[model samples]
Target chain A: MHAQDSSTGSLIAHTESPWRLFWQLLQRDRLAMAGLGILLALAVVALLGKATTEWLVIFDPTTVRLVDKFRAPLSEASALLPDADRPLTGVYLLGTDELGRDVFARMLQGSFVSMSIGFVAVGISIAVGVVLGGIAGYYGEVRIGPVTVDTLIMRFTDAMLCIPIFFLILVVVALLPASIYNIMIVIGLTRWMGISRFVRAEFLSLREQDFVLAARALGLPAYRIIFWHMMPNAMAPVLVTATIGVATAILTESALSFLGFGVQPPFATWGNILADGKNFIFDAPWLFFIPGFAIFVIVLAFNLLGEGMREALNPKLQRR
Target chain B: MSTAALLEVRDLAKHFALRRGLLGRPSGWIKAVDGVSFHVREGETLALVGESGCGKTTTGRAVLRLIEPSSGSVTFDGQELLKLNAGDLQRMRRDIQIVFQDPYSSLNPRMTVGNIVGEALRVHGIARGAELNERVAHILERVGLSPDFRHRYAHEFSGGQRQRVGIARALAMAPRFIVCDEAVSALDVSIQAQVINLLKDLQDEYRLAYLFITHDLNVVRHIAQRVAVMYLGRIVETAGTDELFDNPRHPYTRALLAANPLPDPSSPRPRALRGDVPSPLTPPPGCAFHPRCAEALAHCDRQTPTWIQIARRHGVACHLHQNTSRQGDDEIPDG
Candidate 1:
């Protein structure tokens, strides 16, 4: 907030951008800061895993040692390697699965798959939603060359909204290849309706704002007014929505993988890791807890960040 | 200042369609600006004075094509504004601009003061880079704001400062005519005076013509050389400012003049007009002001009074001043 100088009776320039102010406000929110810390750590680990997966990982997550299958954890791995001739190279930090693979290395690798799908799917969805929604909102009923546009786009959006998004994703995955890329594309396509509706609502309200009229009165082209003048102001809510949408996309991917319709084996996502742990839920509960806990933390971090951002950007809610 | 009018509007009318019920069929129309005709000569201010919902602001917007007129001709320097193609009309917008009423909403919050003013320049391709910044700073200074304030966003400025920025933005286009649509109505009285004075100074400097739309009669008396009083959607009376103030011919004009607050404590407060302004949605069959007009005759309820010339450059649309043959139905009688 800017304050007037009493001494000189002049306006002191406090030209801090809203994002900068939002950051300053967010710094005070301890829970959100904790979320931010967790998110940053996860992102760093994911990036490192992506870069050094072949070189740095001690164990190949797929390598199955039937003799060492279902090893308990660190204690069992060391006990199995007791003598001087014992093989210590295949030690599993987080124990072996039914197929005798390292859970710890798999978890690290799973972060890469889960987080990438989350971000890329969200990015694709935001792009599609913002463009389509902006068009529908700005020009309620417009003609492009010959065909009327707004009705077609909005009716399509409405039709898309009528279907359950998860069901739609399931159908898409069933039709196409069930690879990570296909899952991401399907999630991106299905999940964009929420963001599109949000962007459209923002644009509809912003379209009538005096600044938009002022831009028109200044003889700016319609595109300039819509994209440059109105869209920037409308981005605050879109940004908040996108942040939360990332969490949803991640959760959706995990659920799909758990259903065996997402990323297949050889690739380790949190969902597949959870799927692997389902058989051992009672005996070796660590498999279920590890991946489930990771999903919960990632989603919680994004949600907290999104809520803090909403409060920070909103002028009425900015007060301590 | 030249005698040639910079902007002229003839038979300007804007009717908004009201869509009632679920099917959204047009039920009726709100005649916001019906058959309004006026012109402002260079370096002169023509104030459109009316109460709320009297269509003064609508008239201003209609002239600029911000709200497209239902029917009429808007000629700026003999150019047929409505007839021009989109590109040509946009280009012509450089010469004809408007300053809106609300300061807060008028300026884009995302843009700094410099960009707000420079947008007009840049859009018109008048300047860019160092020249654009220099022009913006210069205009800011001219509007009584510091050049350093250019970096500040719209929210940082007070209402007065924002209004100044609005003025600077309009001036940046170097427009010959500007429609100040209640530009000073939202400001403090002291700030209003300063802005009015600034407008007068700018007019003198640029030889600018202004179509000032406002409900403030006193501000009009100070700033406007001529006045047009609107009732519902029609101009009830128009004359030179002093003449309209002293010998207001129409009942509505008299009521408006009487409503002006007197500063002198010795003077008694004049009686306000009875009844509310009739809705433009369903304007009274004949005279829109008859329901509220103190001097409304029985004939006023039956016939819409045509413009009757009362004196040199003075006209009133009322039966009380029926002293001449009606100005012909099709012809616009004023310059």
Candidate 2:
């Protein structure tokens, strides 16, 4: 009866209605919102770096100069550099790394690496896991195909789940030549199994519903039937899982780099810089403090955001 | 409409393993669908009515091979549907569709109405762009909705509208046979009427065949041309709608009729049927209904009654209905 209003007005669900609900939950979690804000700011810095700096300059983060090495932050001794390599001491306020690289520039470049990997990997994990789960849950009646697939998928997930992911990731990274792309793909591909199981459980419950039967009756094909229709209907719990997964992925990548397995040496990931500053902790505390705080805020932010989304998206919570 | 049988399920059976031995062999089977059979002629509505655990849903799913049966053959038109490959089976799906029970969780919230309906068209390569738009609009209209609904999400719609959208999505595929598996059971009474009426109108326009499975005899009575009453994975009685209701042959069917409390208090109501439905896994050795059948005799306890064809196109599974006089001396306490 409510959608009857579409007769008079627009076809889309009033965009404001759902967003308002999202806003209400998100706003209440001040910490999550703050984390969300910080990550967003970091993203903006990464995206707009070209506009912010005159030279699109060494977006190739790997280029290095050993001679201008380990220049301390804003110190007079390490201040000067010639034209081609010139970054003003005032301009490069965070100072340079061991390669005479501006730490701020490297940080901005590295933000792109860390966040994109975190997001893309999680996205892949969620997509693959959700599809597998949906099929296993929905087609419980079909004995032959799903039985083997479900077993393969679940056992694979079990293998991944039992192994310490950090240790496994290190071993995997070691086997391959260290690259940001490699880390992103490896993390994303391996992490989807748990989400798949969770999604399957949701689908198992949801497939018993009448509308789904109605959709089936209408002869919706398998792809649209499952992915477009059934999956979205059964997606809430998965969304919560995915949100938490993003934070977990970020933390994993950071930990890997810190242990000298991820992002590699001189690449200056948040983990690399934090590890770099550990030696200088007694001398200059700001280096460890800033990046350490960034990691803490982001992890906390994603966790809070995940919580808010869970409460917001969960139909059980909607009733209250 | 052309004269043809829309769908036919011959001796369909699906036995689910209840428990497996250490060697992975099934120790016992829950005979979920046991040699059940029925048909829907073109443009006719056939209802399969049974209490919960009666395999009505299973029968419906098995007919379309949604749940492949342990044994049996199903032919839609002249073609054998069970033999079709996955791709052909997918194409066959555009012909025989199903409507499920709960409206709330069926439609994908992320998909807009247009995509939901248009997907079937895309998969079958029926329409695209402007033609797809027009076809989608046409379908929305056929289901008593405006074309404007094309862009909306399921969450925006009410239970009834979502159900309509569910209907609209089905109709978009232009299917010949549909299994409405308790489609209206979850709706409010008013909404149920709307959906039922909509289904009727769409049936008339499309010349569709329906295998409507429901526990609600009232709905079956209103819509079914023929009705089959199922019990414990077996259909015990089947006849034309009026004949089955007026002269229900099986004790289970009689109990089902007795259990349905009519709204009018003035009408005589029979005594309530007692005892739970017997488990499908470990059913009574003789008659599956004998554990609770008041008319069960010593003979009833020793042998399972075969489906006897009585009246024209009518069948029943009870020894009591074998002759002019009832077999058992005991009478049901109707007071």
Candidate 3:
């Protein structure tokens, strides 16, 4: 009996860590695994692109060479290349654009830009969402002066939601100088309402949970109770929202750049690359197709990963 | 028991206001805990026994000010708790801690057991670093858990072990009073015995006063020095545990005691109390339990019963006991 009990105990200990359990659950989903694999590859590509462009200077995406223009995929760059440029130049793997820029080099840089924008925008949104939502849910019906914090914050969120977000982004980006930072900040600020609403809903229920009550009973200060105790428990939905939000932010940046408002020229972005290639759709299908396919795969991968996380985190759907 | 009470709650009430419509206008109040008055002396256990929705948990929370009381007073060691400022109240919480009902949800799942137990010590600025770890291990040992168990998370432990972790958390505060709010209600019957004994032993060691809130009559008889029986939102009777068990006063108290199942199959089951507990949102007039009280008087439907002392440390709130009162009647005022 003791031996059996010990074995069961060990089994339980093995699966006890929540993150391990979540990973185990996530590994069971094939689509999520595929998405994860794709994301990992993209991340490596983005990192290498960043290193080469910023520090290594191995790939220059902006060098104009009219001779290399409209080179088909898998074809070598002009054979008349000088020895100095020989080491740096390569075959147009995904073909060249109208500006004679190597599409491959531009794409590598674009990957980094897109990935950073996705992460930074979502980071800003998550920060704003968690704080506002926590305050709204924890201090529900608490009046600061004229109105309850819940009502005031929720009403403002609702007002923000009513605005067509893309158009709002368009208008804001139009007024401001087209800097990458401004686009990230604008998208982050505009897109936080959904995340805040999710966090508020989670907190509304979690605030009534016994652990929260126990925390309060222990005399934890309000901030400690909210951030330290409650926030960790309320983070599952927030994480799923964030995972999907990254996809949306990437899409938004891409759309903005496609419309000539994204990260300006000299800085390669998937959206601007696609925009630059739209004019040559018939002559050089690789330019438009490559960037478009990359965007499609990335957004789809994020969505899949987010869905997997949601299913894994849900207690009711747990297999064990 | 000592004459000086360590924790005293007087006319404590917690009325949740029901709001409706978009504008959120106050519709009415659900008086979950209305006019509850009780006290626990040093090293004594005052078990607040009641049915599920009788406001026993509410009363316990109000005493600790976990759920802020809508009205009334909670005094701990001569200090008015309800009147203390946020900072002072937080400081005062060092002497008052609580053990929640559901062991599963009581401990923070994301925190390791050591962090959970040592949190109070850190929060109160009582200990830090090595001292905090030592204290947490000691407290866990005191609660009958292996000191090494502190390294694990709450989910890794069984229900009984998790409960010990919860106790260790409360014990870490070195609290004078701890509200065990149905602390053992969710554990198995065998585990319940072990936890109750641990609580008793801890009380002896620390001179801790407990407002043990539960509906388990058998458990109450085993641990509580005093028992307060509640029906709906009010305490119907309060007496010495043995006295209340041997000779229960008030129809609600009698019904509750009679409802406890016996060990022998041959023993006939007492008639169960009829109807559900009246909704606290719209409680029946006069006695809250009148609709279900078998021996309810005609006046019980029209006039609220006054709490009267029938014997020393024994009080009953029923019109039947009103005439036999030895002291002046203490009418429980509505909140």
Candidate 4:
């Protein structure tokens, strides 16, 4: 009896919780770890930018000096501003743009804008996707005249997909006033189709599960069945989609700003700064290269994180 | 047993329409449950037995209105379930519960056993807080699980334990009738007996009625008071457990019984029915079992046989039993 009790104790001890297993799986992938590290560092940078700009006035992003214009990265600020009444201190870390504003300060401010747009846009898309997808999948069989709820919603999604989204965003953003909120809303509204499809597919399969049927048989309301019972099961794919979606939203915002359709001037977004550096690309490559590299690294980080999450969440791919 | 019927299903049918082309045009109807009729008295077990895709599961689902019946009457305690509005039907579900076949799929993997069992109580506003936890603990203990096990998720348990969680979920509502749809079919042979005995004990303790649907004949013989053998989409024979096993009237019922595996190795294997079950999409015109029935008559292919009562609580829908009926009326027999 004592031996049997010990054996049972060992057996119980061996069963790891699902969350711990997911974390363990994620940790094994070196590329995913690199991605997570990059994203965490960028998040800290974005938060620091917000704090410095709003509360502590650390780096002045908008201050301009005509003498310091077109200074290469790591150039001496004192050398550029010699014999000045207000002599600049330290080195120009990432150099100055054509407008003579500090590149490092602008990049820091841009980090905050890019990160906020990425999150808020993805949040909007996830909300729209889950709602539309939940309705489509759960009530897919319910027919209205010739078309089903599934058919109607999916066809609308297909129609949205058919349009070249960038051009559509270009036209809409051109018509609307240039603001960060407008950019976030437009990118969010257009990019939700893929997430919706993921959610719809998840719901379609999940609704037929016996647990869902059991929930129904237990006299739970339709809302409870959809949100409480089915949504949690459908969330893994949605999380992956939303992670990738943040990257897409960030890229789109950058592209829109580059084309002069995104967040307007006075706000130093990466895209606008890149747009400013376009004419002087050869003379001051760091101005364009710095923001360009930032965008690339952040997007790649999010994509890697999303892929890692996908593999970790999938039970078939999990290692014992 | 009580003479009053707790649940009565009359001429229940569920036809699934096969869609074709991009527009989803109706190509054909698969009559999954065609004119199935049965009842369960208070605390009685009525086993609906059939092979896979024979509509026994569908019948049970339709009776509870889980999957809506195409056309039929399901009267649960004299309340027409089909006619009830959404809210009323939902309210009515508290009394009628179901235990599913696959233990792995029947439970929410994310939920703790306590939440899975206590969700119904919270949803119906029956209990909350400490009372809810106490109830969940009590129900868990009743299903032969430790009260401490309620904190664990469904993935931590074995197949038998998961099934017990399912039963506890159903039993939490204090339901009068439960449709056990292949409840033990997914468990091991050794575990099957334990679940069956647990179900039996629960029925006696709660006076719960069960519409037990399964293809396993041994389980039916062990737990059921009455057995209904289905062929194609319709019930061919239904009788008392002992009467059906001792004297099966229909050719389909006999073939099904003969096909049961024997423990004795030296015993010659009984000749099983020839050919597969006909597809419900396009079943044979007359009796659906004509192609598979060994004693098929020429008229069996051209005309359908009417249901006839051979004795008290014994009925068969076959041409061979057409002439041996004590009650000559073509109407379905009611208890």
Tens-digit lDDT string for candidate 3 (B249-333) = 7898888878898788888888798988878998999878788888888899889988888887788888888787787447421
On the 0 to 100 scale, the lDDT of residue A36 in model 1 is 87
Which of the numbered candidates is closest to the native, going by highest lDDT?
Answer: 4
Q: Spell out the clash pairs found in candidate 1.
A: none
Per-residue lDDT value at A131 in model 2: 69
State candidate 3's TM-score.
0.94
Q: Write the per-residue lDDT of candidate 1 for residues A1-320, one digit (tens) a residue.
A: 01121112555677855566678988888888888899999999888767555566444566555656666667355354334322245456677778767787788789989999999999998899999889888876576654446666877889999998888888888999899888888888877777778788888888767778777778899888887888888888888888888899889988988898889998999999998798899888888888999999999999998888888788885541
Tell me how candidate 3 scores on lDDT: 0.85
Candidate 4 lDDT by residue in tens digits, B190-226 = 7888888889999999999999999989999999999
Clashes in model 3: which pairs? none
**Chain B TM-score for the candidates in order:** 0.96, 0.92, 0.96, 0.98
Q: Tell me each candidate's i-RMS in Å.
A: 5.9, 5.0, 4.8, 5.2
For model 4 the local lDDT of residue A245 reads 89
| Runs of candidate 4 exceeding 4 Å displacement | A1-17, A79-89, B20-25
Q: Which candidate leads the pack in TM-score?
A: 4
Give the top-scoring candidate (DockQ). Answer: 3
User: What is the DockQ of the complex in model 3?
Assistant: 0.46
lDDT for A154 (candidate 4): 93
Please rank every candidate by DockQ, starting with the best. Answer: 3, 4, 1, 2
Residue A185 error, candidate 1, Å: 1.5
